[model samples]
Target: MPDMPALHALTRSIDSLAPDIVTLSDRIWDFAELKFQEFRSADLLIGALRRNGFTVRQDIAGMKTAFIGEFGEGKPVIAFLGEYDALAGMSQEPDVDYPAEQTPGASGHGCGHNLLGCGSLLAAIALARHLAEHELPGTVRYYGCPGEEGGSGKTFMVRAGAFADVDAALTWHPAPFNGVRSTNNLAVLEYYYRFKGTAAHAANAAHLGRSALDAVELMNVGVNFLREHMPQDCRVHYAITDAGGRAANVVQARAEVLYLVRAPEMSQALALAERVNQVAQGAAMMTGTEVEIVFDTAATNLLPNLALETAIHANLVSLGPVPFDEADLDFARRIQATFTREAIRSSLRLYQIDGDVFSNEKIDGTIPLHLGLRDFEGRSHFRAGSTDVGDVSRVTPTAQCWAPTWAIGTNPHTWQVVAQGRSPGAHKAMIHAAKALATTGLDLITSPDLLSEVRAEWFEKIRQEPYVCPIPDHIQPDVGWG
Candidate 1:
């Protein structure tokens, strides 16, 4: 445990700096930029860190928006990772029941990444200031990770050895509750399968035409049946990206389907992906079409670290949850009404939260330490999705904490979530998160013994084989589209 006075003082200091942090969050929220396109958000965070006396490095890992800011020196190169990317087609005005669109069509900060980035920056700056004042005997690095929402931005950074030298890393996300990520996440692989065939007039010469679409449909059917035999937790989803020619009178010559395969471990995911490829091949052969597959992206599952998680949970308990006002509660109630009654009940049950209305009602904000891993629910149940953070845990000791920045039952990638991105309750949550993260960084820096234990445990639990990149080196990030 850390000194109570020091931790309390740090928390107070962070609270005092809430206005500045909230301003940053608001600016990023207003920008509402997409993954790998967080030019303004990244610049704002980097510029602020530089002003605070940290040396800055832009374009780390060959990414234009990716950057690293560092301060202090020596053992335990602790890094704080930050992400700032909005979702597509989620723009909305603040605090409104009716969806107030930003434009006819555009992106919005539906994921609360604006808060994610600024909260981390606040932590980094606070920790840097603490180190300078106390002459702390360790290093702190702020990683401006971009494209977290489906961009595999951190995976590329990891491949480039951006985090190779770091002793430990800490990150946080904006969620409906405050808790440490305990369970492992499913590994994922994404790719596109295409079939080529001869085109001919559909009505005049139907026998002369070979339909590539038939191969795609057959492949999908085969994989759908394979799901019955696969593990219960394993997931597979696909979307037809192309169906060849548009003319109804012509047979389709080329067709493509984007597929995402996920499992409890990377090895399983890879094996399943290979099986899916075989199914595609069989379909092509049966249909007399040529098949081609292209790898898009891949990510490993999260490796849980008890040591790091304990430290983060302690920090979370000390800092406590954000306090909410009556007005906040009123607004949250309205938002809750927008969702289905069953959704509200399910969300409350998932996080063990209690609330009657939609307005932002601040709940208890203490990180439960003794909560066993088995007691923690799987993320698969809460809004089905995958993250590249899963990859980071495989290589190093890593843990992520979630701070309640949204109303209960607020779903990500929605206009409602975007509306709450800059709310007072959200701002308060980010400030509290910054304090917790900074305090944890301090603990790692001051306690060399703790870092060693964490590293040892991480190594013991990690797989023996070297990590294989899911996306081949040939596929570069297409930032323009994301």
Candidate 2:
């Protein structure tokens, strides 16, 4: 393990604040606000940072929920990126194995971001306390990043120069396994295609009414056909946000659909987005309807730092496994029962774990809880999903870990995740992640050699291909709640 002065003090500080941190996480879970609207959730974290004696700033990048909290002065600044947003229509009763919503048609922490935000907060608090006690020269910052669910909150923050001065960044996610997130994820671009035409009676004026709904359908078809010609790694997904009208007797006057294009690189994603736009234009010409393309948001592809990942992996190995008791194990088993065999297999594949290791010798048996850390590979891998964190990575050296909070094979953005949001196992996972992050922060603050190595790697990568913010300058963050 890398040596640092008084590492125990940082871990002990986190342990002392365990109860309060868990309470904060549970409160956020209860609030369950959606993207760009996490007012109550942001307030709670901001209040905690202020009480800890850190200077706080709000409304970053013109975003109401985005903020930053800082402590200490000067170079070798380390930042902890925090997220506290929930998914739409995922409300569920806590501790329930089945799908039982606490509030119908409301938001819920289906991705366990309640734990994610609080864990990062606790890490920042512990690091700040250690720095103040030791009179350290470096600064510790907590970035209250909201709207990670399709909003690209961090991307806007990066464009606004939020992470320009930081030397290195650390973050962790609540996952089903404990390991370093040593992977390269895709970059993405999102847009809304709206078509307008004249509304008329379906039977009496079918020829006069150029149906906007037809244009929307044709656009989707053209994009589908274009898919076969694009790169295999690229992906395109869409959801019809507005389908003209419910009545079939009337020719629809307006229709809209949202498109998300993703690729291994930002340039590829941007080029593919233009192709998608051309398809939309073709559809508009075919149907004689006026089309409007509105930009939503965008995120860059992640650049992994092996030096930072190795340091974080050392801390995780030192922290050992999460202390899961019988009650926690029992709850995890019940949650695993709710998952299908295919889901379990898919999750196992994602984590690079064999199925036999998760099950006993019996034909039908329960999947055990993953209390121990997986073997660290210390290699760069690929993940199909995209994150706004990728934007931060482009600006500076960034590393993140995956701490096991849910049962094995419990996928995110599901009722299973919401059900276990407030469980004892999840709280333990949160604290474990905090300790790991804090210890890594200590190493970075004390060891200039390690920080230099991390930066050297980041510099070389960005030197080859300079980063350009995918979101254009003319577009502003969509502040509407809908």
Candidate 3:
């Protein structure tokens, strides 16, 4: 168990701050800002941090929405990573099972980032209070990271050396279950392949035309062929950003496609990227067109630290489970009715849970939420999805936990998640996560040997395979990229 005084202090602080925290999260959910354009959302978090006695710094790392709030002064600086950006075209009415958009085309918190950011802020505030009351020599910082959806906001922050001085970092995601993410996710690279060629009318100058659309088609075909020979773990996906024009009669003069490549390791991702580039070059040569490979953004694979995860897991065990009431369970069952049984099984598989246990509704009609904590036996789970958090883990000893903020089978970036964004259950889960993270923060701050063990694990891993920011220095966080 953690220190009694520190635990009580954190719990007390969270209780006092619970109402305001819930209000802030709901307001951010309303704002639903997207990517670097989260002006109102950033202002809201910044104002909250300042009001709570945290010294705030804005516009760091060349991104307007990116900022940090710090409290206390001294040796062990613990950071809580928070994100408030929402996904586009996901706007939905809260507490509704069916898809009803709040606005026709506006954004929504499909990934529960509103709960994510506010929960982290709550943890930071509670930890700061604990340090101040105990006269502890430590610093707590809340990182207001924007653009997590498709925009690698933390990756850019890492390149600017934002987290270089922090001893440890903690974060949490709003999910359907409570568990620590001890895993190595994929490293991803995104690029735009724009092709240029001479435009000519279809009937008048058939011989003079070099269709860029043809080049795009050829390149996609080439990439499809390359997929068979590449490593099974690597992935290559593309979308036709531009097909030149809607006029089928005209020979297209320009075309563009966005490609996202992912792999288990950065070296493998880079190598696969080169092979894809070669394929693009070959297509351009065959079509008599020039191709431009514009670098979009990238993030390195995760470097998991078992020591940091163990501390957070201990706190989760101590906290037992989120105090979800009957009303929460009723809402969850309603939301679960919208999705299929297979979706619940898929979600269980993602978390490495046995599908046969709770997936069948006949077996347990009351399995609305997986309220118990999962055991983290010092092993890394293999997560295929990528996140900018991977970049932060490469630099500092980073850890994150998932809280049950939605229904049991609800996946992220979907209408179902948006529907439950502002529910009472979501708010309770947010507070539950705050307690876990704050207690873990207290552990690192009060215990020197524990912090040293965490850092030792981090340093040893990076020493063998050094962390190189996958996003090049030349690429700035361009707000208009998306």
Candidate 4:
């Protein structure tokens, strides 16, 4: 770990970059582009990185929005991950408490990726500047990861060997609380299964038609039955993306269903996915339909690095909680008023802590120092949502932290979350988070003992069961419609 004086200097260094950090975050939030289409957001970050004397590389691993910015040289190359993709149909006007959409159901930064991307980039830039000023022998990289919403952008990057040389990784997410993200998240597999059959006129040749929709329905039923036999920790969900046609008279010729299978581990999730495929094939056989399953992507369960998490938490405590004024509290109270009692209950249920985020509106002004350490498998606050960062963790010694950027009880991908996008509190929390992440990066770069212990744990874990890309070699990134 870095000494107190050095840590203070690093914190001050990141704080000085607050203006540029907030500006870049607001710019990306304004763009509000969807997955794989963050052209303007990517350009903004890339430009800022170049201005800070970092070498920029565009369109990594065939993702147009994905890029990498590198600074410095030599061993212990540390990478800071940044994601800038927005969710669809979540747009809301800034600084509003009501459910008002900015463009009436357009893309928005409901998940705070605008803040996420910029904060991580700021961490990288601050670290780069630190290295240059002190003439340190280290490397820093800012990974411009796109398509995190239903698109595994980082998983694709991992498969492309993007983090092959990275000695360690640090990242953070904008959330409703300031704490260490020590939870073990679910591993997931995403695939689209299509069923094709002969189409026929319902009135004249109905008997000649084989209903592909029937196959889809049957497959769903089979999957529901399998749910009972599978691990209780597993989750299976599907959407009938195409149900033949809108016309009731026609016997549907073609139908499609997208499936997402999640479990506690990658091996278990893969097994569950195989059973799902079998169910699909059975459905096809029974209905005389030809089924084709196209692989989309998958994310491994997040593996935590205790060494890194503790170091990051120390930095968070050193910075203390983010300060909020009367105006900030007033706005947050209004936003909290919009949420129902059930929403507040759900938000705090996972943490099992006091209810400060609801009434206080600025989150619990404390760091979760021993977060998930004593819990079962470090999953007492297990994340139900999947992230491409899980894939990154498999390859590198990675850990993440969380910073409160919105009012409590505001669910992600909702207009309520987007409403807080431009709040002064939100910007302050983001800059504070950047300092925490950058400070952690500095500790790893300077301390060989800490980095070695972290990597040793990571390697031993992987050695027992090595990482296998969930997406097959033939499968490519399935970019969603913008």
Report the CA-based lDDT of candidate 2 relative to the real structure: 0.90
TM-score of 1: 0.89
- Candidate 4, residue 3: Cα displacement in angstroms equals 2.7
Alpha carbon lDDT at 333, candidate 3: 86
Q: Using TM-score, rank the candidates from best to worst.
A: 2, 3, 4, 1
State how far residue 180 of model 3 sits from its true place (Å). Answer: 1.2
lDDT of 4 by residue, 1-482 (tens): 34677778777888898788798888899999998999999999999999999999888888999999999999889999999999888878999889877798788898999999988988899889998999999999999998988889899899999999999999998776677758778999988999998898989999998989999999999999999899988899998999999988999999999999999998889899999999999999998999999888888888787778888887877777777666776777778778776676567565443333343332332221112111112223567888889899999999988777776666777787788877888888788788888888888888999889889989987787688878777776666466
Sort by lDDT, top down from the best: 2, 3, 4, 1
* lDDT (C-alpha, whole model) for all candidates: 0.79, 0.90, 0.89, 0.83
TM-score, cand. 2: 0.97
Better of 1 and 2 by lDDT: 2
RMSD of each: 4.3, 1.7, 1.7, 3.4
Off by over 4 Å in 2: 354-367
Query: TM-score winner among the candidates?
Result: 2
Estimate the TM-score of every prediction: 0.89, 0.97, 0.96, 0.93
Which one wins by lDDT: 1 or 3?
3
RMSD of 4: 3.4
